[model samples]
Target: MTKIPRGTIAIEEAVLNPDGISWMAESATLFNTGADPKKASSHGHTPQLLDIHESRLAKMDAHSVEYMLLSLTSPGAQGEPNREKARKLAADANDWLAAEVAKNPARFGAFAAVSMHNAEDAVFEAQRAVKQLGMFGIMLNDYQVVGEGGDAEGKKYYDAAEFDPFWKAVEELGVPVYLHPRYPQTKDLERGTRYGDRKQILGAAVQFHLDLSMHIYAICSSGVFDRYPGVQVVCGHLGEGIPFNLWRADHWYNKPVKKATRPSKEDYSYYFTHNVSITTSGNFNTAGLKFCIDQIGAERCLYSIDYPYDTIEEAQDWWKGVDLPADQKEAIGRGNAIKLFKLPLEL
Candidate 1:
C-alpha cells in the first residue's frame, strides 16, 4: 500500500447504522415502501456498521487511511417532525459517535449531529458536541424540512433570518459545519426525473449536491461569512457541481440578472477561498478530482470514501495512484483535512 503524508484524514466518511433512515433510502421509498424492500432492510444498518471498530479499522488498514472524521448518516436527526424527538435523536447519535471515536482515538474523530428545527436545541447540541464530546465539527443535512410548505416554491430556508440563532451558535462554537446533501424538494421532482430511472438516481445525486452548494452560496452571499468570518463549511462529492461550473456561475453573476439578493462584486468563488472545503466521498473520478483541485486549490479538498455505500479499498486504490504533483496529492490526501479539522498528527 502507498503511504500518504503524515496526519492525512478523510473528513466526510459516514458512520451510521444500516437500519438508520438515510436520506437516500427514505427518498427512494417516497414512491412506495413496498416497491423496494431493500430500502427498508438497509434502513437501520448504516450506523451500526459504521460504528463497528474492527470493520472500520480493517478498512483503514487496507486503504492506508490514517484517520476518518465520522458523521451520522443522512436524515438521521434531520428528518424528524417533532422537535423534541429530533433533539433526543441528535443526542443519542452523538453519544454513539463519541463512544465509537473513543474506541480508537488515534484513527477517528466525529461530526456531531444536531436537530436544526429548534435553533436553541441545535446550538445546545453544537456546544455539547464540540466542547464536551470533543467532536471535530457538526454535520447538517442540507435543509431543515420543517413543515409541508418549505420547498423552493414556498421558499422557506434555514438560512433565513429566523435561523440566525443557530448560525450564530455555530460561529460561536468555532467548529466547521459539514453540509451533507439530501433529496431534492417535491416541487423539483419532475425536473430531476426527466432523463430516466437512472436519471432519478443520478439526477438526485447531482441535484442534492447542487442544492446544498447553492444554499451555502446563498448563506455566503447573504453576508453570513462577513458576519461570522471564522466559521467553516464543508461539502462532499467534490463540492456538488460547484467546481465543474464555477466559471459559468461567475459569468452569470457578471451579466444582467434579476437579483433578489443584492449583487456584489465578489463572486461565489471568492467565498470558497476563505470559508469552504469539500471532500471526495463517492466521487472517485481522477479527472474530476483533478479538475476540482485546479478550480478550488488542493488546500480546500479532502479525501473520503462515502462508506458503506462505497468501499474504502476501491477509493484508496484509485486515490493512492492518482496522477498529480506530490505536494498536491499530499494536500488532497491528508494535509488539507488535518489543517481544516485540527486533527492530531499521529501518522
Candidate 2:
C-alpha cells in the first residue's frame, strides 16, 4: 500500500451498483456508442466503479487518500423517468452506499443520490440519507425529467421555483449539493447540431462542461442564495470555466440595459465566492489549478480524482507536486473538503 499522506481527503470519487437500477445494464443500448459500460471501454479506469470493497479501499490506501466521498455515477437515479422506480433505485443505491461506508467509516464518506423526479421525495430521501443513513451530502446529476422522459418541457432544474423546498431541506440539513453533469436530453443534444463541427470535434468532452455550466449558471443567477444563503453547492472541473469568465459574465449580465433579466441582485461572482465551491476533478492542468485558486482562493477549492474516470495515482502525483505553499496545497488537497463536508479532521 502506498503510504497515504498523513491527512488527505479525496472527494468527487464515484461508486456504481448495477443491481440498484437497470441504467447500468441498459447503458450500452442507451449510449450512442452501443458498447457495454459494464465491461468498460474508453471512459477511463472504470473497474473501481463497481468495487466498493478491497479494490476501492486498496486504491485509496495505495494512493495516500485518507478518505473518499463517493457518489453514484452520472444519470444514476436522476435519469430514471418513472418517479416510483427512480425513488426506489435511489434508496437502494444510498442504502448500498451506507452499508459500504459502514465497512470503514473513517475511510469512506457517501454522497446520497436522490430522485428529483418528485420534489417531495427528493427532500424526504435527502433528509433520510443524511439523518438516518449518514451520507455527507447529495449529488444531483444536472437535470431531471418529470412526468415523462422524452418531452423537452418535462425537464426540471433545481433553480426552478418548485425545487425551493428541496434546497430548503438541503440548507436545514447542512450538507452540500454537488451538481454533477450528464449528457443533455435527446432534444437538447439534437440542438447541438448547430455547432455540428465543434460538437463532433470535442464530443462529450466540451459539451459535458457546457451542459453543466448552464445549470450552475442558473443556480448562481437564480438568487437561490438570497433566500437560502446557508445552502452550499459544489461543482467539479475547476468551476466549469466559470472562474475565468466571472468578470465578463457579471459585467454583461449586470449592464444597466440588460439588468432586468438579472435574477439575482448580487453580482455573479458574489455567489461564486460565497455559496459555491470547486474541485480539481478530471482536469489535471496545473495552470488551470493555479487560475482557479487565484480566482476562488484555496479555501473554496478541494481536491478530487473523479475516480473511475481519473486515477488516484494521477491525482496524488500531480497534487503532491502542486506549486504552492504547503499550507495552501494542504487546504486544496484535503483541508477544504474536511471543512466543507464536516469530516472529523484534527487540524
Candidate 3:
C-alpha cells in the first residue's frame, strides 16, 4: 500500500450552522418523498456535520487528510423556496463557515454557499463570501428549487443567460464553483414515475448524479464555459459519471444537425476537460479512479473524502491502495487542488 502524503486536501467535506440546522431536513421534504424530518435531522452523520473542531480534526489526522474545504451540507441555500430568506441564509451560512475556518486555517478551508433564487443576489453573496469572508470557493447545490409550496416554478439552472453576471463574478473572483449533488424529489410526478418505490436509489445511490449531471451537462452545452472560459467548475462523485460517458456524448454531438442546434462553440469534451475538475469524493472505487484518470487525467482530479456523509477512513484507505503512479497520486492528493484553488499550504 502507498503511504499517506503530507498536506493532502479534501474538498466537498460538509459542515453546518446551529441556526441553519433545519435546512437539510426541510430539503428532504422538498426533494425526498420518504423523508422523515426527525430521521433526516438526526441522521448518524449529524455530529460530524456540525463539528468544526476536535472530532473532525482527529478524523483527518487519523486518516492522513491535512486539510479540508468545507461547505454547508446540501441542498443548502439553493433548495430554499422563499427567495428573500434563501438569500439571507446563504449570507449567514457563509459567514459562519468563515469563522469556522478561522478557528483552524491550516486544517480547514471552506466554500461559500450562495442562494440561486435570484441571480443578482447570488452574485452579491458570492462576491462578498470570497472577498470579505475569505472563502476559497463557492458551492451551488445543483439547480435552485424555486417557488413556494406546490407552486414551485421548478429548478433554476445556472446555465441560463440571466446568470451570466454571476458567472462573471466567479471568474473575476477566480474561484471554482463546486457544484454538489442534492436529493432528486424536486418534482412529485417525476419522483413517483421513476424513483417512487425505490427510495434508496434517489439520493446518492443513483438519482443524485443522474439529476446533477443534467445540470452539469446543461452548463457544458449552454455555452457558459465558452462565454467565460476563465471560469472553473468542480464536480464531485467522479464528475457525476461524466468522465465515463463523455466520449460517447461528444461523439454523437458531431452530427451536423445537432451541432447546428447546439449553443456551445466547442465539443462537450472540450468544455468538460478544460473547465471542469472532478474530485474523488464519495465514489471510492480504485478502478473508477483509474478510469477517471484515463479520461480526464490526474491533474483534473482532486482527492476528497466527502466527509461525514462518507467515512473519512474509508476514503483515505482507498486512496492508499489505489494502483496509480506516485506522481499521479501526488497530483491528485495535493498538487492539483493546491494549484487550482491556490491553497496557501506547504506539504
lDDT of each: 0.73, 0.81, 0.84
TM-score of structure candidate 2: 0.90
lDDT leaderboard ranking: 3, 2, 1
Give one digit per residue, the lDDT tens place, for model 3 in 53-113: 9888887888788889999998888778789889888888888889988988877888999
Please report, as a residue range, the 10-residue window in candidate 1 with the lowest summed lDDT. 195-204
lDDT by residue for model 2 over 1-347, one digit each (tens)? 44335756878888887573445544332334445546743333345688877887787777788888989988788877778988998999999889988987878889999999867999999999999998999999889866664563367788889889998999999999999887544444445464432435222367778878998999888889988999999999888878989889988988997687677878778888899999988888899988888877888888888887777888888888878888888888888888899986555
Q: Which ten residues in a row have the lowest lDDT in candidate 2?
A: 195-204
Could you give candidate 1's per-residue lDDT for residues 239-346 as a string of tens digits? Answer: 887888788877776555634455344677877778888888888889998888888888888888787667778888888789999888888887777777777763
lDDT of 3 at 114: 92
Best by TM-score: 3
Residue 202 in model 1: lDDT: 40
- Residue 52 deviation, candidate 2, in Å? 2.1
Cα RMSD for predicted model 2: 3.2
TM-score-best of 2 and 3: 3
Which residue runs does candidate 1 get wrong by more than 4 Å?
Answer: 1-8, 17-39, 44-51, 148-156, 184-199, 202-204, 255-265
Ten contiguous residues minimizing lDDT sum, candidate 3 = 184-193
